[model samples]
Structures are given as structure tokens and as C-alpha cells.
Target: MDHLAFDDFPDGLIVAGPDGRVTYVNERVRKLARAEGDEMIGMPLAEAMPFDDLNGHTWMECVRPYDGLNTRSAILEQSWYSPRGSEYLITASLKRDRPGGRVQQVVIGIRSARVRNRHDRERSDLVATVAHELRSPLTGIKGFTSTLLTKWDRFTDEQRQFMLETVDAEADRLTRLIIDLLDAARIDSGRLTLKRGPVRLDELTERVLRSISAAGSEPSWRMDIGAVQTVWGDEDRLVQVFTNLAENAMRHGHGLRRVEVVEAEREGVHGVRVRMCDRGPGIPPEARQRVFSRFWRSGPGAGSGLGMYIVGGIVTQHGGLVDIDDAAGGGAQIDVWLPVNEPEALRDGDDRGSVIGSGTTRG
Candidate 1:
């Protein structure tokens, strides 16, 4: 094995002894520590590389022997300040190895995480502030529109009809924007709450299908519900999940005529696997990795990038996994996996639950 190759690795790497003393520091590690070549090699692990976690834990304290393995490991995020009064975020992982029956050899890898965290935090703050500012005006508009519609008999027929149509269109637009803002806020705060409950999968799928049909947008849409009777989850959130998937399929499915929802149990866990397959030009392989990212859209005509982001967040909050893959015959398929043991209480109206857990749909 070429030790030099390891030294040149992208992540910082350091080796420590059983006594928790640094024995070797790779080039990357030395550079990150801003230390001389020999300074880090002989010092105690804590003193040679001092770092503290966001929650105030020392770096060494967090890396324990890996559970059930001779090696211990941990990934830690810590902040460091430069002599010039600037701060940097560092993410480091330590792994203890027992190679050749030696238990004392510990390797630590470190990298910069400050820029990423800062960017994410800033974006979240912006979303929250924008959502808050927009809510009051949206509410006012919707309220006045409702009042006018209710007072329809007081106006002439022509005036009443025109007002009603204008109000209806404006209300719809406001509602969509509000929903987007809410989703953005929930995702930014990581506070979406889930009201989990035991739900019949068959009934839930049927309800979503009927609701989408009643909306009368996609008359040619088709849904296939599986035989799985019960799944543990928030029914409303789950509906939002499917609704987003179905809508995305309809909108981006390139004139997709039919949508399908399939259910099954796998490996003893009841799973409701909903696949929204469309006939549109399928997502390119290069962009598949980002399909679920926030504010990500495929092209100019694609809808707001928030839909898939909301879908991913909702499924994840339920302890389920969601992904986009190539459909069996054509188009992109959004597959969602929900655990059967998802709590029934998550479906209740507990607004304070985890923001990620609240399955709210966004347009």
C-alpha cells in the first residue's frame, strides 16, 4: 500500500494510537490544522487538533468504539475561527481499525462543511421571512373575494358573474402561492409534522384517485390501487404525497394519459409503493440525482421546482423513502415507500410535529 496515495486523499486523514495520541497526520490533515508537519504527529489527540461540536462536545468524546466492532467511528461538525476573526465549519469523521489484530490504530478524516451549512441556513432564513410576509396579504385577498361571492345577490347579473369569475381565479392563484410558501417554510425549518395513524391502503388510494378525478383536470388519468389493506401513516399526508406524485406525473408526464398506484408487502413490512408513470419525455439520466432537490426543475416549461421537493420531504418524514426511476415501459416513475408501522398519531392535527413530518403538498 502506498502511504503517499493515502496522504494525497481529498479528505483529511490522521492516525492515532490506542492511548489516543496522534501517530501520523496526512498532508490533508496537516493543511487543515494549519500546523507544521511534525507538530501533529506526537501530540495527544485532543491537544494536537482541538475542535468542539455545535452542542459543546469535544471531538474525542464523540468518537467511541464502533458498536459491536473493534473500531469506533463518528462524524462531527465543528466550527473553527481563524486568527483574522473569521469562522469556518469543519466536518470530520473518525474510524478506528483493528487491522492485523491491532486495536489502537484510529484514522480520522476531516473536510470543510462550513460553506455548505451557511448557504443552507441562509436560504432557509430567506424562505421563512418571505413566507411570513406573503401570508397576510394572501389571506386578505382570499377573505375579500369570499365576501363578494357571498354578496352576489346584491349585484346585477353581469356584474355578479364577472366579479365571481375574477374572484375565483384570483383566489385559486393565491391559494397555490400560499401552499408553495408553506411548503418552503416547512422544508426550510425542518419542522414539517406528520399526523401518523393506521390507515387502509386500499381506501386511501381510492380516495386520492376520486379527489383528483373530481377536480376534473385529468379526465383520462388512470389509477391502479393495490390490495394491501392497512398501513401505518398520516392519511392526509400520505394523500398529499400521492397527490404531488400524480400531479407531477400528469404535468410532466408529457401528455401522460394514465397514472398508476401499486401496493405490495415486502420483507414482512407492509409497504405501499405508489408509482406515477407518465408517457412524457423521460428525465435524462444525468439529472436523476437532482430530481428531488428543492427548487429543481427539468426545463423552461416544467412546473415550479418545489413539487418534487415537497414529495421527497413528506415521504422522508414518515420514515419512508422516495425516489425517481425509469418507468418500466416509458417516462419517469416516482416511487414512494412507507413503513407499515408509521404511527397513527402522525395523521392527527398535531401541527407542532416535525416540520419534515407534516406532509403538505405544494404546487
Candidate 2:
């Protein structure tokens, strides 16, 4: 491999000789470690740099070469601090190489954990504020409405009916908002739980279609249920995933002529792959990576922007991967790849009654 190509690698790369001296540091490493101007080559690995891992270990300790070539690789978590003293956690992998019988090289790849941590913190704060603001009013409305129903016999029929309707509408709004909050919280904390079981995916799709249809939307929907019959996941969270995708299409599929949800199975490492596609104006290439990020909205005042975030989180919690790509006919397609086998049992005890919503996913 050309040495210059290492500079373009997305992750930071550092190549050190067997003597524990730096031979080459990639552009990414230079930028991240703030080592500019003079080449890092020829400097002792430990003496030339000052960096600490997330566990407060020295960079040298974290990146020490292992005994075997290509067989021993380890992940190191490091912390990088900003000028203002905010810290970021980074995870890097160190790989050992021995080539030409005379050279031993160690390559390091670095990724910033701080960016993800900061985004997570901001999302949590936002969800908390929204939930707190909405909870009080919802509680009062529900409480007063319950009181009225208790004394319904004293009120005229029309008065009672009106009160009931008001209560129902408020309750519905509160329920929807609360669900959104819960989802936001679950996603932010990386604690979203999945109850994996054999699921009839087509049945789930049809059920979601019927539910969406009942809501009185005119958008044309086409679904292709291929030979795939079963998936392993929490049925309810899977429903939430599809429902959020459909809701996103309804909200953003404005300019498109039709929206379609297709289901099919493709051979995957762990199992089969299930996908969902939409006909909304295709997401721009630049924004595709961040589409699943929390509170990421494309256009001005477009949405709360947590729909796809929740979808990604729920799918991920199930040990699955989700992605956005261009639709065949012009739109954005969201595909989710789930393992057929159940993932490792969740660490948190099985407690299924928790509700999911915008800012939080539980009580």
C-alpha cells in the first residue's frame, strides 16, 4: 500500500516501528493530536506526544504492539479535550504488521466518542424540557376530566358528552407527545430494549397499513411482501419503527406521487434483511449520514426530527443496522438489517410495560 494513501484514511492512523518510535502519522492523526509542521517521523512514540485514553492511560500503553501479526488487535479509548476543557472520548484500534521480514509496524485508527457524547447530552436535555413542560398540563386536564366523569350523573347528557370529548382529545395529544418523549430518552441513553421473537413481518406491515389508512390520508401506498415470513424482534418496537417511517413519509413525502413500503429477504451474515422504502424527495447525499441523528431536521421548521432517530435506535437495540439510500424511483429509502437469531439477552431485566414517546421511553 502507498504510504501517502494512509493520509486519506478517514480514521487517524499512526505507524510505529518495532522499536516503539513513530515512523509515520497520517493526516487525520496529525490534525486530531494537534501535531503539525514537523514530521512526527523519527520521534519516540511516548516522548513526542501527550495523549491520554478515556481510562487515563497513556497513549503508549494503549497502543503497545501485541505478540502476533494480524492476529492481535485491540481497541483503545482515549479522551481529547477542547480549548475550553470539554473532554471527548475516542476509540481507536491498534493493528500489528510485519512486512519484508525486517519491519514491524503498528497502525492505529481513531474515532471521536466526544461528538456522540455531546449530541447525546444535548438530546437528553431537550427531551427533558419538553416532557416537563407538557406533563403538568396533561396531568391537570386528565385529572379534571376524571373528576367530571365521576360526577357525570349530575350533569346534563350534552354537557357530559362535551366534557368527555375534550378529555379524549387532550388525552390523545398527551399520549402521542409522551410517546415521542419516551422514544427520545430511550434512544439518547442507549437503553432502548428489544424483545426478540419470531415475528410475521407481513402481518406487522398490514397492521400498520390499516392503522395509517384509518387515520384518513390520501397518499398512495404500495407494499411488496416477498417470501420472507419471520423476523426476530420486539413486535411492538418493530411496529413503532414502521409507523415512524410511514409517518415521516406522510409528513415529508409531499412532492412525490406515491409512497411504497417493500419487504424482502436477502442473504445476510447473521440472517435475512428487511427493508422499507419511501417516495419522498430523496435525502441529499450530504445529509444522509446524519439523517438518523437525534433532532436533525433538513429544512427549516421541518419536524421535531426524532422520528428517524427513534427508528434507528429501536432497530439498533435489536442488534440490527438501519440505513438511508436513494429509492429506485426517486425518494429516500430506509433499510434495516436484522439478525434472524436473537441477540444476546438484554442486561436490563425484562420489563415490558414501559411506554415510548418523544423525550423518554419509560416511566
Clashes of each: 25, 16
lDDT of 1 at 345: 55
lDDT of 1 by residue, 131-240 (tens): 65467556656765777768856878787667667767667766775687687679769988877667765556667766766777655645554444356677887777
Every candidate's lDDT: 0.64, 0.64
Best model number under TM-score: 1
Off by over 4 Å in 2: 1-167, 255-267, 270-274, 298-303, 342-363
- Candidate 1 regions off by >4 Å? 1-160, 255-262, 266-268, 342-363
lDDT of 2 by residue, 1-363 (tens): 477878788766666677868878888778866778556888886754456544566655655454434554555555654343445554444544443233355565555666788888986987675766577558768776877868867888888777778778878767776787788887777767766676765567668767887788753655554444245679998899888877777678652233323333345344434455566677888888787876677764355567788888888787777777888888777777765553344223362222223221110
Would you give me the overall lDDT of model 1?
A: 0.64
